[model samples]
Target: MTAAPHVPVNLADRLSRFSDLWSQKTVAGVNDYEVKIAKLKGEFVWHRHEDTDELFLVISGRLTIRLRDGDVVLEPGELFVVPRGAEHCPVADEETAILLLEPAGTLNTGDAGGPLTKAAEPLD
Candidate 1:
């Protein structure tokens, strides 16, 4: 059997290239899952996708996931999962870069409001 083509992503390079809040690119995928890199700043919209759970991995800086019940802050090399149907909003004090892994078609913003409503942008 042959191996799939593999490429190493320079996380620092990607972060430096994209400074916009919530700019994403699709890296790779298989079946129903996909990997994405997103640069986030300020506060994101409050919303949730009922069909899929989202995984947030902090690549640099820090990220805070705000929820109705509580919130979680993720530092570099840290990660968290916001389960399906849970209301959440992501916020970064300065600039934050994260790798999001989830099923395809997961919405960036959940069901609430305040801008940031779009499908995941492929960041490869």
Candidate 2:
């Protein structure tokens, strides 16, 4: 038997070209779900996606997801999903690398925080 061909992804490779707070890099796409890597810092504006919900998995560092009433702190091995139409904010104490899975066109942030919230698009 033979193993599947694969490429190694180093942290430097994934994050070297991306430094923007919400800058994203497309890793892979399988059907309706898209996998992406994002570099996050500071605090993200509170918002929500009107359509499909969002999924997040931390690769390194720590992340905090703030909801309308409370927030959840996520470590490197944890995951979180914010339901559609629910306002939330993502904040990081330090630079954090995270993998996200969501339907195409799903915004990284949400709509509740006014104009700063961004609509989903290619990072590079």
Candidate 3:
């Protein structure tokens, strides 16, 4: 089915539909990329997307993108882009909401597939 024309997707309402950490829900699409939202907590695996960069925008709480060189910390309303092929891990001390922009079907775990790897599901 197609979405209704001219009706904007509400991010907060979409986010409220789920509470599972580390699982991404597709909110919208931009060409070949998907705009996804996820609730994150604790530490994630070190992984790298060899072909596409990943953009992370924090909507609530704080997130730290840990890299080999250093860590990039982001607060609410902040964002960071992890360059392609760069090994990085995401860590959040508490529950954090984030929006991600990446190629459609990109695995959450990237090259380091594990139990945390989740396929993006469209928001209901």
Number of the top TM-score candidate: 3
lDDT of 2 by residue, 11-33 (tens): 45766766777766666666877
Which model, 1 or 3, shows the larger TM-score? 3
Q: For residues 15-108, write the lDDT of model 3, one tens digit per residue.
A: 8989999999998888989999999999999999999999999999999999999999999999999999999999999999999999999999
Clashing pairs in 2: 47-110, 48-110, 48-111
Residue range with the least summed lDDT across 10 consecutive positions in model 3:
1-10
- What is the full ranking by lDDT, best candidate first? 3, 1, 2
How many steric overlaps does candidate 3 have? 0
True-structure lDDT of candidate 2? 0.76
- The C-alpha TM-scores of every prediction are 0.85, 0.79, 0.96
TM-score preference between candidates 2 and 3, better one: 3
Better candidate by TM-score, 1 or 2: 1
Candidate 3 wrongly placed segments (more than 4 Å): none
Q: What's the candidate order when arranged by decreasing TM-score? A: 3, 1, 2
